[model samples]
Target: MKALFIGGTGTISSAITKQLVEQGCELYLLNRGNRNAALPTGVNLIQADINDEAHVAELIENLAFDVVADFIAFEPAQLERDYRLFKDKTKQFMFISSASAYQTPLSDYRITEGTPLSNPYWQYSRNKIACEDYLMKQYREHGFPITIVRPSHTYDERSIPLGVHGGRGSWQVARRMLANKPVIIHGDGTSLWTMTHNSDFAKGFIGLMGNIHAIGESVHITSDESVTWNQIYEIIADALGVKLNAVHVSSEFLAACSKVDYRGGLLGDKANSVVFDNAKLKRLVPEFVATTRLDQGIKQTVAYILAHPEHQTEDKEFDAWCDKVIQALDAAARSITE
Candidate 1:
């Protein structure tokens, strides 16, 4: 198999890159050469800014691929660019969409490919929905060989996953846990969520490459295991060898208090419980199974982040903001009693 991946060295794509190489797939990664150091031996690198379309066009004009995937494209316009570039060049085109594109305040908690696509709280999810719509239109009208993939709450060793965190990253929340500071969990921390290990995500994704039956289909690859936000936080705390100092906060209040996109990241997505049914993915990729449990994956992540200083970035602003939120809520309680 021959494949071209744009933005290959991300948290999700990195694992796929390694797995594809191990499976004897000829892989080419087109990205700025900033983060490609750990890539496997058989991988080819096309170091260029994908935004530089004219240059990229000149670079890959002579190349044809079995599959071309875009991990960086989020907007409909960006996907339109992909369509123009790879219309006849690749046999298969994959667009990485988001499961958050599913209806917010969901009519049903059980999610499948048949679930309606609608998310008004987050523009990010809306953009993904628009991209999916555009690709499906192309697939139906023009017979474009497109496979839309939705990955929900996928994580790797590079970063810890969390429900409520700042723009900086999830490291700050992990840092708070290490320090025994009260970490925020949106909406009483009981809302169910799914987290897919990127390595496990790779197994399902690799199965779809060059898959004829997957053409013109949209499938979400996620773990069947679902846990509440409280369990998630508790797992992280246990991984770090610390007692969970959890502060339950309303999603609405957090949306109002913070500049972060809590309205979308919380209320639109994480605040609501969601359990993914990977039946479609299993039918397409028979061997697909998510072996990484929450405790297992998070323990590896916690160990890696602690050992590497580069991953432990401190966000004093977010830390102070968390403190402020906790304090204001405490004062309101005192006032109500007095």
Candidate 2:
């Protein structure tokens, strides 16, 4: 199968990219070629900004693909650009949408593809919803042949997945854990969340590509394993060989105090308990099963980060922010006691 992936080297798409190559599928990645991910031989790379439609069009003028999946499109306008370029060049055009597009605070803690898309707390999610709507409309009206795949909190070996982290990445939180510094966990850390290892996500996703059943449908690929936020942190700490010094804070208070948009990330998405029902995905991709448990995945991630010093990027600003938030909470406790 000839598949074209735009922005293939990411936490979610990278694993899929590697898998396609391993299967000996004719895969082409169209991106700026800036990421450090090693591409297996026999894979083609088209280096260009996907935003530059005219230039990208010229580059792939006569090329036709069985699948053209864009992993970087966030907003609808970007999808509009994608629609313009790959309209007829590919048989199946896949859009990587976010699972966070589901209704915030959720009427039901369980999520299926049928779950209504409405996220007021986050414009990012709302934009993803718009993207899906536009693509689905094209599929219905003009036969754009779009397939949407939403992934919930998919992680790779490069970075640890944590509920609370700074703009830089989750490495800072892991560093704090290693140093025995108090690591802030959003909410009480008991809110259930799902994390899918990228390889596991890749299996579900690859099963959908080129399959006629997946066209005009939106499916989320995630592990069925749902663990509490506290459990998540504790697992990471265990992997790092450190006793967790967890400081739990309310998502609301964290949002109010921090400059980062915790309201969207936490309130809109993570803070609330969420359990993904992968029934539809199972029906579509019968072989798909998330084998890597949270403990196993977190341990591998922590190990990868530890071995690769480059991934251990320090975010001094976010670290300072964390310190400030922790100090304020402590002071508030003291004031209440006094």
User: What TM-score goes with each of the models?
Assistant: 0.99, 0.98
Q: Write the per-residue lDDT of candidate 1 for residues 1-338, one digit (tens) a residue.
A: 89999999998899999999998988999999999888989999999998888888999999999999999999999988889889989999999999999999799899989999999899999999999999999999999899999999999998999998888899999889888889999888878999999999999999999999999999999999999999999999999999999999999999998899899888888999999999999999999999999899999999999999999888889999999999999999999999
- Candidate 1, residue 276: Cα displacement in angstroms equals 0.7
lDDT tens digits, residue span 1-338, model 2: 99999989889888998899999999999999898358777779999999888999999998999999999998989999998898989999999999999988799999999889999999999999999999999999999998899999999999998888888988988889889999999988888999999999999999999999999999999999989998999999999999999999999998898888999999999998889999999999999999999899989988888889989899999999999999988998999999
Q: Name the lDDT value of residue 54 in candidate 2.
A: 94
Clashes of each: 0, 1
Model 2 CA deviation exceeding 4 Å by range: none
lDDT of 1: 0.93
Instruction: Return the TM-score for candidate 2, rounded to 2 decimals.
Output: 0.98
Position 118, candidate 2: lDDT: 94
